[model samples]
Target chain A: MKFDAQWIAFITILRKEVRRFTRIWVQTLLPPAITMALYFVIFGTLIGSRIGTMGGFSYMEFVVPGLIMMSVLTNSYSNVVSSFYGAKFQGSVDEVLVSPTPNYIILLGYVLGGVTRGLIVGTIVTLLSLFFTDLQVHNVAITVAIVVLTAMVFALAGFINAVYANSFDDISIVPTFILTPLTYLGGVFYSISLLPEFWQGVSQLNPVLYMVNVFRYGMLGVSDVDVGFAFAGVIVCIVALFSYSLYLLESGKRLRN
Target chain B: MAHALLINNLHKVYGNGFEALKGISLQVEAGDFFALLGPNGAGKSTAIGVICSLVKKTSGQVKIFGIDIDKDFSAAKCELGIVPQEFNFNQFEKVRDILLVQAGYYGLPRSLAEERADKYLKQLGLWDKRDTPARMLSGGMKRRLMIARALVHEPRLLILDEPTAGVDIELRRSMWSFLRDINAAGTTIILTTHYLEEAESLCRNIAIIDSGKIVKNTSVDSLLKTLNLETFVLDLREPLEVSPTIENFSLRLIDSQHLEVDVTKGQLLSDVFSRLLQEGVEVLSMRNKTNRLEELFVSLTGSGAGENDEI
Candidate 1:
């Protein structure tokens, strides 16, 4: 329909989403920040001191980008999956389904909300990390671009998860089983170079590893994986997830009926 | 009158192979307050769901204001508003904001949506709670808020599914008056309620759907005329034994002091009165049980009529 009208709907849904998380800041925003702080304390301070260098940079500096990306990924994915699923469970989603707003606009509005939360949490964790270690960015543009792209990719994944989720348990299943394993093996604490060549090749297949290393490269100018390959991986994931999410919305597969 | 809604042989079967609707068809005229009456599991909601595209229809077609919902859903939905049976608004949002967001979904400009939101909220007695979150409002207020949200875009046809389900008597009356006022202003209202009296009072044309089939569809006046039985309740001043004069009329003694009788259209009431006098039975007061429409609804739908069974 009209541009202004679609913009209004976008802003309304975004505002509602932002308010929902902020209203329960303890659960939505604070826990992730605190969890990241614990990782910095336990992993960076306690463990990193025992094992000094990780891929040429100091242990604290090497893990900062990975930890920040980790927070961004988890928060963005959880924000959208939980919010959209909650709307579905409460039947409030019918408000959008019955309206004249285009399906793509609805999907984008929710994806943006998720991305916003991810960026917000990522910023907070980055600031928290600064207190423990002196932070420096070799390329601010690449760092910003990689973090935003990573958030977008994960947000789209969350929307797909929400669409397929029939119960609250369904929402948590992926985060615990799939996401946790991927992030753990994504070189958050150690470089993939330390593993054997075969394991390194296997780790190359983990998408989160590419994200973490690329973000590390942006901050430290060093990565266990090629920066170009990392950026390419992020772009491919974004395109694929974006197209798939759009297709799901257009088909009205599980969301509509 | 132009038809506002036309359904032709709509069908719906669930993925599990359970059929909810079976070839249902009906037409609602422009500006006509049409009531679809049926029991639970009778597919009234399923029919609404299919027309709104919230549920997949197995076959048939639905046209809203001459636009096919299947081919031109956006255009069709733009002209229709549905107030669902459940409270589906965001409870975290303010009453006014809920309506504004719904209007935005319909692609209405901010200024226009806000103005319409204010108008409807005030008319529905929800303006005082405009800034309150929907969770804070009572059930009746929330229901009214939904009505306000549905009317924000000012569609040509409005479908209300049991809008007064759990509301009190006073609120129900006020809601009915508000709906009637809106209908008078040219909005076609399609209501589905278990309360048959509400339908009988508000709708001129009615459709009785039973077991997912249209059992009766006709003007209210015509349906009432078909019921030839008129019930008369007489209060007797003195208790009287059985008399042969009373045998001429079909009568049942409800109690020692009250007698109920059914009088056909061709029978004269004066004859009953004269016969009662001849039998030495004093008649204190007499009144018709109710309007003929009540009897017609009971007989046609086969729902027994009792004073407490108004719904």
Candidate 2:
């Protein structure tokens, strides 16, 4: 491959994807901000005041990292799924496929587009969290790393979902049946330690639990799961999902022919 | 240096056991205006799909300018452009944005892309619609937009599949002039059209495919030469109460002031005029009853062009 052409193609797709979502900012960017605000108002402010504290931090502050992670996760996943599926549905994907853009560049460009939305929403949700409670970053590196990795993993997951989806309904099924349930049980509103021993083990089986805890640990210096194990798990999942996504792209699964 | 396009033994079988193309090999020399015509389901689109990498070939070698598609696809693809029969652009995107994004796909810088976008849009009479959303454009303008988008990279070879399928005649004529200018400026063009007249008027060489095979491949003049008989429609100076008869001539009275006649090989059209004049029917104007190539295409493909065939 000519490296310059590859980079150019990647940037082109990335920029186009960004322009698409940004152009419809009302549809793409606003809803999440409103939803996150409602979550902060309802769960963190009203319910949190009565609960008082958990995990050695104020209840509002305790839920802040997870909420931010939730925004990042969902936004990352939805952005790629909708955008990619739209491309396929409208046959606009043919534009890139018939061009000199390499498959990997196409993949990276879309993934980065998802990542961009994820981080933007994450930042907005984080800023919203500040209004409800004073927050501190116990570890900046872990905070950035875990959030980035989690966004990437879900973005890859969304890419795979879009590839396999034959209809618009197929794209939303996984998020509805799997992602929502996993995130809610992943300790966003409460620590898994509050659950019974068996259910806590069950909660640990959820991948989102690992991400939310890692993010929480980065913010509050407190976690129910081992920080080292969470780091390892997130890295492994990222590597595995990234490899699989690349494989699907290289094989042109659901993309070509 | 090699031919502008070379496909050797290309084959494609759909998942449902229908073979769309079967071991078709063809070449278009550099700077040639070539036409690929076929009835519906005759494998023209399939062959194009294989070359554009939109469809996976079961087996074949495809080279663009001597660069094998498999070995150097980016380089090969960068050297070509495709205007598909369908509109495949992002509907929500502005027309100029569509062209710019297509340019970016080919690694052209923004400044050059904008320059080319303006140039092609102006040439195609689409500069005024640059800011409008694509879906708002008329069907003819949308086709023009696809052409502008394809040419942003300044590709050496351009392939058009039924480019004027739904375009109005006035727009089609202007588009033909635009295409002629580009072809004259040295961009090799490969066209597939249902309009046999379009092919007959523009293409230098032609290939007709049927049932996944190339039925005829030759120069346009040579292909037309195979046409042994051509029918002509004549407008008369006087109204005829009845159809006229000329020796060894197949003539029919279309109306009071019109007549249709067949002129076979080795027969002079002047003789038909003289014979008609002797019959007291003065000829005002004469024209082919139908496109000459359309007739030949129907003969070769075993089916008519621009009809109900949907392969």
Candidate 3:
């Protein structure tokens, strides 16, 4: 009920979450950084050299924003899904649930934790990419806005996943079966314009494609997808996921019982 | 005094049509140490769940401190604190942190939360482990930490679900004393424990639930009086086989040299001694089994002995 007190709960959960991942930084923070570096090396360097250009920009430059977005999305989603599910699995979520904290406060506390991890991993990957190719941001506002919004959207998605997950494997199933496939097909390395007209239209439906193109537009001032549509798509996903996650918490589906 | 917790016609039927609670109703008075005793699968946990809003009730209403849980859940919950049976604190956090965070959840400022955290952690004898991660503490310590966390908000009613289960005798005794102190200070305590002796010692009012219904609900003294079963044990100086005529004493062999029997209040012990002597069974020393609550619990639940008596 008190704003100051609710903020304290939010900060407490956020601190615990940050400490949880940082305590095992080798597992939580380092893996994504290493994976992103590998992507920059293998796809950005080796493949980009052979492919020439994408959307009027050098392939390496074009892929930089997409790869960063990929890291943000995966790290943000996994940070919340794994942490929240781990709490449930360990039977520690009862500590939070039994407390007087409102459902929305708990939801935001976890979302912020996810966003923090996303931003940290994104920063690390950005610095890693600099070792291979110089990058520039055409619009700093759009760049920061897209990264934060994408992280927020995915973090909410992860919260929903944690709500329904009965086991640890359930948390990873979405990433393996759905997330990986969508990311690989979401224009991380090549422009959607290169695909056939039918495929181009089909790719528009993949939410990750919209995110990747939006980030690309921010960094290189070029995108195969319409920039205005990309921004609208990200905003809509954020609002939708946020409302759905809050509804799930309020209903206590798979959570209270 | 107003009731601290009131449940009216509560029902919970699982998805498979297994009714855990069947229109059960009960009231716990303010400042009363009420014990809810039942066998496993008898809906003890389900009742607690419904009261805490963790499990949905198929029908009925729950009021805490005169506030309807359905219409004013936050206000109702503000008056209650639940110490679950499971150790459910964030194990990665320190003992002090867990308590402080719990206080914050109740809308307490940081300074007030810290003060209450320190107060409870010290009172629960967890001050020394304040900096230790919860996961690293012993089971007893963890259980105490949960109690501390629950009490941080100073709710009017506290619900403890098996608070002493799996704890050592020393810790359990200390916990009982702590609870007694809290109850004396006017916090209504509702406890569910497998230990009948705990209820006998701490609770004045008791409810015996079986198959989701209140089979027996009465004052502890009245319940014990209704049983009228007194246990007497005689230790014999010499081992002897009792004569068949000694059956008049209604004795059973507790061991080769010992005889045990349950006698009503008006029954005479002298008659039993004379009958045993007539049968050539030597009696050296006699004593009464003082754990009357255990005996009553066994009788009411229709369970033969103490082995499976834990609820």
Best by DockQ: 2
Better of 1 and 3 by DockQ: 1
How far residue B68's Cα lies from its native spot in candidate 1, in Å, is 1.5
Give lDDT for model 2.
0.90
For B1-311, candidate 3 gives per-residue lDDT tens digits of: 55899989888998889999888888899999999998888899999988887888899989998888888887788788999988777778788988877787787877898999999988999999999989999999988998998899999999999999999999999999999999999999998988998999999999877777766778899888876668788888887565234543566776778878768777777878887777777788988776787777767766443323222
For model 1, the superposed segments whose C-alpha errors exceed 4 Å read B237-248, B268-311
* Residue lDDT tens for model 1, A114-144: 9999999999999999889998898898899
Clashes of 2: 2
The candidate, 2 or 3, that scores higher on lDDT is 2
Clashing pairs in 1: none
Residue A52 in candidate 1 has what lDDT?
94
lDDT of each: 0.87, 0.90, 0.86
Off by over 4 Å in 2: B303-311
Model 3 residue A134 distance off true place after TM-score fit, in angstroms: 2.5
lDDT of 1 by residue, B142-227 (tens): 98999998899999999999999999999999999999999999999999997877888899898877666677778877776676
Deviation from native of the Cα of residue B8 in model 2, angstroms: 0.9
Each model's total of backbone clashes: 0, 2, 0
